[model samples]
Target: SNSALDEIVHRIITAGLTDAKGETYIPSIVRVGVNAHHSISSVSMDSLVALRVESSDRAKGKRRLEKDRARIAILDESSIVASTLAFSGCSMFSRMTRTFDVVVVDEAAQAVEPSTMVPLCHGCQQLFLVGDPIQLPATVLSDRAKDHGYDHSLFKRFQTAGYPVSVLNVQYRMHPAIRSFPSREFYDEGLEDGPNVVADTERPWHKHACYGPFAWLDVRGKEFTPEGSGSKANRDEAEAALALVKDLMVRFTELREPGLMAVISPYKEQVRLVKSLFRDKLGAEIAQGIDVNTIDGFQGREKLVAIFSGVRADDKKGIGFVRDERRMNVGLTRGRSTMIVLGSARVLRKAGPWRRLVRDAKARRALFPFTRPFDKSIARLTSDTYKVEDEVYSEEGEDEEWEDDEDDEQDVDYGAESEPEGDWIPRAEPGMSDDYSDSGRA
Candidate 1:
């Protein structure tokens, strides 16, 4: 994931610091001289500012036309610039007789065998291939080829051959409640949440007694509709999800950030429905902060909160795209703290993995009915301008402690909900253990 790099970039831009350690790169000059050119090696704060101004200028593209072709050639030939080369560029470079010190490939599990070889053939002394095979396999069009294991990525092949591999056990992404199911079901309870994620992080969903950071909403009434020639959509689930979005937006105003909350589903048609409903009810400004898309659209991205709209509610026919356990694995792990699932429990219980999740949510007291009482909570937000946490001490009286009324506690009936019995829940294949060892040899 780019999460590690993203955090580093965030720190650099905010602090104008270069080194990841305590050391900082301080330039002697704050502003570039009129005649003197800028350094190309390290990017400074001034370079970022220049880039921003250049990018915003409407005439920036036109200015390229004014420069002479020979002048451009001269500028290009003057410096040896380093840049990120794509897979095509790596193949082209491999044709030449150049040698590299080290080559690092991130997300190597998604790359095909031949594509991974292109970069390895660059005469690099050391190569680092990083990714998890359990997340996604390589795409193979031919069924025969896939049957022979063409779909297995180079990383998976290496792992299967008894090659040394390291597993990152500490996950700083999801909260313990959200991470619990995936960790036990997928990683054998190997994943551990960082201390800060459990302590410092505030989950606004905790205000709801029944629903913690992880919960499921029952939408067994929804019906799937055929979209285009292949996809499907569910109007009932989409509407319920939209209502939950409205409740969260108006009630948790402080937790709202642009793209902080996302609505993800397996079907593209359902994604569109939720997006349209979200835009219609919440308006553009509030809707802009929420992302509505399919499960594949959300990989490699994490948020403070997420809602999964499993639109498949058919009884005769089983869960269509939801049958892919990998998609469910990726979706369950995306939420940093809170995750709400709205789907047909009856329909999902037919599937192996979905049934397991449905059962886990119920056992943890995180299950809620589709038409559960939300009016009382939403009404409180509509009438009160200030949030419960926003209350501060005043000269007239001290700040009152925020407490939930008896009705709010009674809203979620954990014991009343019947468990889906006699349903076969599939056991996920155990992945590599959390215990990691360094080979010191690549």
Candidate 2:
């Protein structure tokens, strides 16, 4: 229930404001599909819970589910707000209440199943469903639905029932490169053609002396589904990812902008493993005390130099949970300059929709070579070396455990690696060159 509803109550109660540190405290829904969560168990399969509820279906005819534990807790106070998977015309939510002041539904796409929401619609006067249908529609994934798809989930159904509705169109999510395709696919038609190579630079940022803050590689990785839902990413891949991390350290030293680089991936396990190994081996060289965050974490932030960790197979299946196309868009957009994905062309080829985007991105990057730097790129890889430990989450109290007292963030900069002056040429197509067709992030 980290839905917008829950965030509002949590922030208003804890921070005493509707906004905290600039994050909107307004009621909304939240679902980090996967990867950001260190544990696969982080997200709930409430669809399964709905089945459980139906089989046992306790609180039978109980009228008010406000007391139900299905929704997560946000505030300890009298009046509270929560996100419900329940949807339009669901009777359980219609009751006039001393129970809640307002209710919102997060993951509105998932909540689109009207049958599951039948109970909540009964008691609530104010209801809202906030989700992007373009990301993933709420319907059976049949070719039939794919052929005749429509956006009319419960929220859309409410509009069909004659309720006045609102649409929030500002996309505060992706970088211009990654956002372009999804926007064209789901948003403004005018937003169709992708990437802004010269918008911010003088007369031509595209070729303006080729600023070195760039790295683009057509990546590839092996394909093998892990044993269980909770299984970790391939350890061999993790070790290779560490080598890439070390390479980034070298790049950061060249750029001398240690504080300006970031490492993004689609997998949380990759993030944990890379961060732990990088810290243990080169703790003194990291930008600062900041731990690695995945693409979702780096969203609103841009880096002068970016080191993207590619842990997916090259053919296509991209990485992590890609049931929704929106995630692929998010991953590609993490870097402003320099994005290096280290997977095989085979994996990218395997990802049908993703292949199109990768092809497009590589083509766009090739049309203009200097956009992101990949020159002087070198990788030293060795596998089956150290057995990566079970992923660990640093506790709040132990945040300082990784800190280096003698090291300041600025001291870690690798001078020459940051600039454009070396004989070392950057590769537009690094690993998965065979499949890239030269499409890359702008």
The most accurate candidate by TM-score is: 1
Model 2 residue 371 CA deviation in Å: 19
Superposition error at 85 for model 1 (Å) = 8.0
RMSD of each: 15.2, 19.0
lDDT of 1 at 410: 16
Candidate 1 lDDT tens digits, 349-370: 6666676786777667566555
- TM-score for each candidate, following the candidate numbering: 0.67, 0.44
Cand. 2 Cα-lDDT: 0.39
- Residue 83 error for model 2, in Å? 6.6
Report how far off residue 260 is in candidate 1 (Å): 1.0
lDDT of 1 at 224: 55
Q: Give RMSD (Å) of candidate 1 vs. truth.
A: 15.2
